[model samples]
Target: MRVRGRLTWGRRARAGAALLACVVAPAVVLSPGVAVAGAAAAGAAVAGTPVCQVRDDRLREISGMVATDDGYVVINDGADDEALRRIFFLNQRCAVVRSVAYPSRPRDTEDLAIGRDGTVWVADIGDNDHSRPTIAIWRLAPGAAKPVLHRMTYPDGAHDAEALLLDADGRPLVITKGGSGTVFLYAPTTALRPGATTPMASVGQVTLPRTSTSNPFLFLGRGVVTGAASAPDGRRVVLRSYADAFEYDVPAGDVVTALTSGTARITPLPDEPQGESITYSRDGRSLLTVSESADQPPGTRPTILRYPVAAAADAAAHPTGSAGPVSAGPGAPTSVRPAAEEASGAGARPWALVAGAGTLLALLGLAGVLRSRHTARR
Candidate 1:
């Protein structure tokens, strides 16, 4: 069902209340500390100013975003509809300037990166079920009409990833999303062939430091890397989770070394609902962020938030080191399967079931409200 224009008040309320119940109910049932911590974190962080609100309904599930001189470039998450699966370029006021269609429907495009030379790379590395034989990346060079596809396979096995980083040399690096704070890194072992699959070797791993940052997802959200970006100057890089953003200094343009053995400055992005998109501003002095509006009220549009680079640097005097190298062997485990993966199987959790039921009720309530309004008008 395609949603067009602004939603009515009843629809908005129904969506908001249902989603709130689904999230809040689980938090209360599980632990009160989670909610309390989230609240405290929200109060501690400096609030980001809203630059602009997304008006396009098709951009509801924005997963990856990158800042451009004109405005920004964004991509939606895995959508069943092929029409919604394209790269969108938004102007400074958050208006869709133009969009470039992918050569084919992407499996699950999760992250986006652009090189210094105006080469855009779209990472289609999301393997939630760990079943995809070969994940892929799409490259759109400067002035190219369409993106060229480059398929890649993991040397070990299939792993789910959402963060993609492009080094100063414009080489793409994929970071796995492991629930346990520790995540593995992978880089292309050989030159990428447009139509042929290339093997990705396990390079190293880094464990994100535990923080007191609060988010809707609570503790589980702290470890997952949702999005990534590099500084335009090539001096720094960042990886963000649902709750916070971690920035590392890239010494001499070696992004891999920075991720494997660097100290990270942590900035809390508190209480973001499914925050998944991040990028550095054109000047590299601030970080811009956007969240998916799925859990927000109906008709709610996602807004871009800007945080100063100094805020992150000043969060801690002596930031703890969170990077470390791991064995780059084929036997190395790339990721610890998240709870959602387990829930996808026979052992589904009770909280997940409750959330599903709440969603159904929300849909039914919206239908009833719409139907009653039509009858009243007649």
Candidate 2:
């Protein structure tokens, strides 16, 4: 009587990918010719090329991604009790260097950014239902014993956010995934004390060009902003979506001006499996993109793509302006946990507990899934 033995990683990612498919899939099935034509058109639109593919199963649900001198660090989007909240470190070859578990559970981290001082900031500010009065941001200086959690509340109201950026001084700045298409700004007004709730200052706004969201397929190229990454010097940044990525050259560290009045260099992305994460390479010469893999049977895993920035940087059509007000917690002293002591390999799997009724569901659900898998293998 197996309970949850058959609930594999690929199956879990497929569930996420299925959601994207449903949103973009057409109601009427396409004819064979139309399908081929659609694929061709899609191919033409994806100009960003992939440098390599990451094969790790743990990162199949990766959401927040940022590149560091050592490698790219990422985290899963799961916020539930049964879900994991760990940081996965990937090297240049897209191989796992390490996976660091959090000291405690994070509510709903959606994006990540690296500050000027080499500190990693994790955006725990996700309010899908706008039910939370306050959201949190986690700060980590790699090899730290624990994260410094900085909690903040929106001054206006609860607004869902997935993008976060730290200024040259390590201050946190958030952009709301608002309906107005005007990227709403939320800057911290005071030093982010670990336990104190700080007020999010609305100092400025960056109104992006409004795009239609009627057709699901087309919407991929024109949906709400999902992720953001700023250049190391705070001189540039990029905003990402499901199917497209826009680059802004922040002139004089001004992000608001770029978002509002500056022209952006748009780079269309290939159809990614629930793609949501984007970042800049350590050298600031290329853009790296990641997707949440729905690695179904005989399908693809999450891909790590590097879009050439040499041309894009030289061809900056319009420069972005900047200004700001924000706060960041004082750096908390940290001690690294020993590699042997930290979870690794199989031990790194999330902390999940199931009992009673959950056990029953696992048995039935696992049986059906196992049966289908066996049939597929045959």
Candidate 3:
């Protein structure tokens, strides 16, 4: 089965009108044993302490993440409802402040890229089933209402895209999510008209080892391939998967340079690795990864892990020479707000809770009093 469809022009304006319209297989049915094993090996390698757990039963897969002006926005290829596509907002310290869901059909959300002006772009480019004709991007503001989806068709029908990245100038670059991966450069001239998407210019391909899969039709097996990002200069790109990561230098002439390799020096994560997403902070000081456990029960929550750019880059540039394996804990720390402002930001929430409790208490007291009065009258 393949997803084939025609693209429409003026997609941006029509997005709002298409806002309202919107399942997955049984949990065990989709599980791949080999994929799980690969995740275990990778997890055992990255042995950092556990970070906080962002619990959500509907979160099936997290494709991408980007740091917005307000905080961090994490995107998930949610389960059940197509409308379940969610973008979670976190504060500077990684506290989730809010979330915005997009009104879209059930398509795979691969990754995200934040524009220079704070435009949140959610890329629905992950088509593992090969049933979608076209992919899309749901755009929204940092604190805006529901997102508006702008659908775009690839030049030659659908291809599984795992990475979504925008350069400093707001041009989109799509990374192929395949065993034999290729990087497609979408020039800024690539317009958003219906049926008008420019065919991706295949600039580079990765020579990597391939793994086995139960379904030959599926391009990417249980192994989730992701983490495509563009540096501030728009000349450098960073990419990674469950096992390996890489950095490339894009010269002004569009020439690409490889700066790091899969075995490069980097902090290791827990052994049960799944759900790999990456994004660079605006300040360029940090590269954050939100990972989910492959062995967790179907509805297990996700984890957001952060790696300092300097340390990670140092390791990525110097892998084998550096410590072969670092240690990471099983889970993350609890979500705790900053002390000084926690009282203020969290104060309003408690009042609503207090009001709810007070209302409940008052209702109970009234009911008891009425009962007593009825008995006396009787």
Candidate 4:
């Protein structure tokens, strides 16, 4: 789909005219690379701004995020035969409340999306090699016994589906991750049975733009689209790819129009960031992005990046405060924040005082010994 948020004509023309005038005037180059690239891609420049960034410490290949009454729920889709797929609960402070493992089939769980009625929808759409024509979604109540399996099979043929979203009425919206992304809105009340082809509508096609650098290091055309959700008003829908997340406003309940009509907006995120799951907070003002642990170092934990959507679209558009992940192993102490950045927080008060006292005592002791020696020599 043609996502929005590209600089409008007025903005473009003004910037273009300003740049043209700059040629006639003496232009001072700021950064070396900036000047060169600015002169090259200046005309076709798209607004690349990062609203927020959170270092995920608990995310192990996070595939989706859903904002719930408790907080944000994160998805971790592990490899095949591992049986390690889990949905983690994180409060506003970025603390992990709990983690529940879905009754996942080998290599089935790919992503997750939550329904309005608080049903946690776990999508088993990850097809690494695109060999399966069918995938499953486990829908369970917050604390319900193992999820009830909801299977989805594509009609035409097999597809590598990755993103899932449930509408306000609790309908399923399954989107396939492919060269030309396909959106399928499953009919409401349709039973998701094995080998069953639910009545679906073709919304449109979407393409995720890949970043230039692999700084955050993406999984390539593998298309790690980790986020999808229907807006709170049910008038809009959101999806995320590796590099950017998109918001679409589908008014007439027409999926086709929503896809083709120029009523979407694309927001650029961090560079080559893999985990792109997003969810709107209960207040509906703030949007949160959760990163995956697979994209980081082995022992590195996941992080939650918070951004005020309304404020980001208006403010300078940089990351706000972030919540890091808690370690998984024992004796790890669940250090949610980086050690260097944790010294000032309330939890670190005792340690910070002890470190300060130790430093002071060491300096005082050294000075006293030196003074004693100096007096003896005198």
Candidate 5:
């Protein structure tokens, strides 16, 4: 079904919300097969080898990624002058097995999500300049020729959104790109209406650490919310930035509250060129990522990389309180910390020692005073 909506001014970005903003691999002209499955790299920010390169001409600029029973569904950044409406389905090794074209012409298609009901959802949710009056989400059932389009409007105004998440109840949730190191959450009042303009309510906000986050003036770092995916079972939520990724344990009712309340488990996804989309594997364990293809060779072809689920789970287990680098074994992800939880433990010992010394001195002074009083009485 075809649908359209007009833009209305909702909320404009605050005064200082824009920010400034990949390499490539050699092209192997072949069908999608032979993706490298090497062990995940060690160390922080390691530009690990890619799982595979998408060589499909039409699928080269792979902007969104989602996992299916047999393969993956992907799309490109709708940044070109012409509008794009086609989505590609790729096999296990990243080959195009099929393509689904729907009536909706998204102004900028940045990411996609799969609902619990087996429907494939495409997020026409990218507004780079914050100029769009409305954003759209199109739902297509498996094997359905046509898609039902859903329009989402921000209560405040148009926002530059890239990440999309469907919570446990199958409700569409959004995290706007962070303009001031804090990303805003938005969602519809209920399960949205098809082909109707629905109002999205703001839920919560998250602020990244100082050592974390970037200036919005740079183009790449604009929102820090490039792609998002939820676990098939709805137990976990994964949010991605252009540079890294974070996983949060979803609370019973609202996942947004879990994210903004400092209950995040983060891991780095280093060295993907213009990474735009993220998804969970069919088994719902590992994470799959998609990046826009770059012209440069020897590195940075539109890449698909997998991060082990255990790595993320291990990080979440070890909340960072102690100071020092979080090192990983040969295959596990290197570090997990909320500003070094273990480091805080280390600092505590020294303070305890100082406190003990102060107590001892106080006791000694009190004894001296008592002795002097006895001598004065004599």
Candidate 6:
């Protein structure tokens, strides 16, 4: 099925909102105490170091990323231009080494995962409007010229998702992008087939606790799962939101159990303009992330940021078996803060007011632009 043109305009609106949050919010907010608290919290969290700048201008909307021995692999968030809808291979310097085309235009490719055998999986499961009949995963095995498409259907209904996890056995897991600190996980009930549609079953759900970590998207960003990665060793898995990365240990190779029952070690990633892509470093000692450059100034290139995993956490990594069955209970909170902070109450009233105003202005501008586009089409 072909993607509707309206989806492109919708993406533009979201990008504009992100731009405002990153560039306009901080400047308008003027509470001295709140500023200090925010700054202090930001400083305590180790920020990611710049590894390399993505030099290719075409890769401005990177949504999924995976690290390789030589470099990395990345995919854009379903661009309207068909020519830009390919899997990009980047060298260590973040330059495009080569690219492989998809067999057909993807609906919305949001995440990437690679297996031990060098098989690459691309998730085309993004349903921002919750209107998709079936989602798909594209597989590109080693030495293959093109990727094969595997269609999948969620048993309950359509849900928006941006994270995909591959277990030790190369089975694919899909994580929904839910609001209010809750997200559901799903896995195929049977093996995936390229020629036929596979049915997916809900494994369990995870609730990411609230954090006061500073981010461009404000309160709502903390709970949104934008991307995910599995360590090369298969002992750890990480899910990232716009604001932070949640890392969980996959003991005995039970990813669902780890996410459902275990507490994650939080790593704050503050102030990314439109962060979406994430992956583990080749040696699995650090996490790598990059943001989309669409909201940046002209000619700006996206930079790859590397955050070191704590030695204690790294030492605890162990090989896991095949992913076990879904466990009961919601994921426990690793760091709990008062929900009042989300509203930026008494301490951050000035900032909250300014931010809310900026958000409203951004939405108004986006509405005008979309209205114009519709008028022209008519």
Question: Backbone clashes per model, in order?
Answer: 0, 2, 28, 14, 33, 0
The superposed Cα distance between candidate 2 and the true structure at residue 263, in angstroms, equals 1.8
Top-down lDDT ranking: 6, 1, 2, 5, 4, 3
Cα shift from native, residue 295, model 4 (Å): 6.4
- lDDT per residue for candidate 5 within 1-378, as digits (tens), equals 011231111101111112100010111111111111111122334443467778776665566788888888887766332333587888888888777776745676768888876788888876654566778888889779977888888999878777888876778888786644578889997667886888889988876432222221121342367788888778777787765567676667457765765344555565454566788888887778876645434444566888765343344554333232333312333323332242244234434434334434433533342222210000
lDDT of 4: 0.49
Per-candidate Cα lDDT values, in order, are: 0.73, 0.61, 0.47, 0.49, 0.59, 0.76
lDDT by residue for model 2 over 1-378, one digit each (tens)? Answer: 001334432344245334544432332122233234344444445345676677876565677899888778888765332334677778877798777666667766789998776678888876655667788888888568667887899888887788897765667889875532456878889989988999988967765432221222243234457789997667778887655566776666667665665555555554555566899988888778887544532577767787765233333332233232111111100211222222232423231111223334433543344334310100
Which candidate leads the pack in lDDT?
A: 6
Among residues 3 or more apart in sequence or in different chains, the pairs in candidate 6 whose N, CA or C atoms overlap within 3 Å are none
The candidates, ranked best first by TM-score, are 6, 1, 2, 5, 4, 3
- How high a TM-score does candidate 5 get? 0.68
TM-score of predicted model 1?
0.75
Worst 10 residues of 5 by lDDT: 19-28
The residue-by-residue lDDT of candidate 1 on 1-378, one tens digit each, is 112343532245335555656554763355444344434545566656789988887788788999999999999877666667889999999999888998777887889999998888999987655767888899989888889999999999888898999877777899997765889999998889987999999999988866656566545567779899998998889889887788887878999888888777666676666788899999998889998655375556888988777433331443334433221111111222343442353323545667556656654654454333210100
Error of 3 at 300 (Å): 5.6
Q: Highest TM-score: which candidate?
A: 6
Instruction: Report each candidate's C-alpha RMSD, comma-separated, in the order given.
Output: 10.7, 15.9, 20.6, 21.9, 19.2, 6.7
Candidate 6, residue 224: Cα displacement in angstroms equals: 0.3
Better of 3 and 6 by TM-score: 6
Q: What are the runs in model 4 whose C-alpha is more than 4 Å off?
A: 1-58, 80-83, 104-106, 180-189, 193-203, 207-225, 252-256, 294-299, 310-378
What local lDDT does model 1 show for residue 162?
A: 89
